[model samples]
Target: MPVQVSPERFDEIVGEALDLIPEELAARMENVAVLTADAPSPTQRRGRTGRSLLGLYEGVNLTRRSPVRYSAVMPDRITIFRLSHCRIVRDEDELRRRVARTVAHEIAHHFGISDDRLRELGAY
Candidate 1:
């Protein structure tokens, strides 16, 4: 059975997962906001299996930015889908692991790491 949690508890888990990031990396993360949603919005679903989207990073990545061109932009958003995660995990422990992995994966995007590269590094 899928593990379920209150929104507050889920947010706590997300925070815990974020804390797993290395301090050096965390320090370099700028103009980014970490958020949690019960589920991805319809536009966010974007033809993918909605439940498959554990998290999303929406913004220009660091590597693609230029000091001159990158200015006056809203903060990047990294959204963790709480319900989607809850629908897939078997227990709280598994949920934590999954959330941690998803959080790392999304943060990697902020650092200009692509999913393909992450796969190459066995990060998946």
Candidate 2:
């Protein structure tokens, strides 16, 4: 069965996961906003129907930025799908680990790491 948690508690878990990030990396994470949502919206889902997304990172990654062209842009968005996480875990410990892993995964995108690279690194 899915282990459910209150939204407030879930938010706390996300915060805790973020806090675990190294300070140097966190400091370099400029103009990014991390958010939590119940689930991804339909548009966000696009045409993928077979899998549920645990998180999403939307915006230009560090490697794609140029000092002249990157000015005055909107903040990068990293959204954690709270409901998806809650639906997959069996208990609080699993939930915490999953959330932490998801957060790290999304943050890696911000730093210009691809899913393929993550898999190569045994991070996935």
Best by TM-score: 2
Give candidate 1's total backbone clashes. 0
Residue pairs with colliding backbones in model 1 are none
Tell me the spans in candidate 1 whose CA falls farther than 4 Å from its real position: 49-51
Q: Cα RMSD (Å) per model?
A: 1.2, 0.9
lDDT of 2 by residue, 3-112 (tens): 88988999999999999999999999989999999999987788767777999999999999999979999999999998999889999999999999999999999999
TM-score for each model: 0.95, 0.96
Candidate 1 structure quality by residue, lDDT tens digits, 1-124: 9898999999999999999999999999988999999988988888786237899999999898888978999999999999889989899999999999999999999999998999999997
Q: Which ten-residue region of model 1 has the weakest summed lDDT?
A: 43-52
Total colliding residue pairs, candidate 2:
0
lDDT of 1 at 89: 88
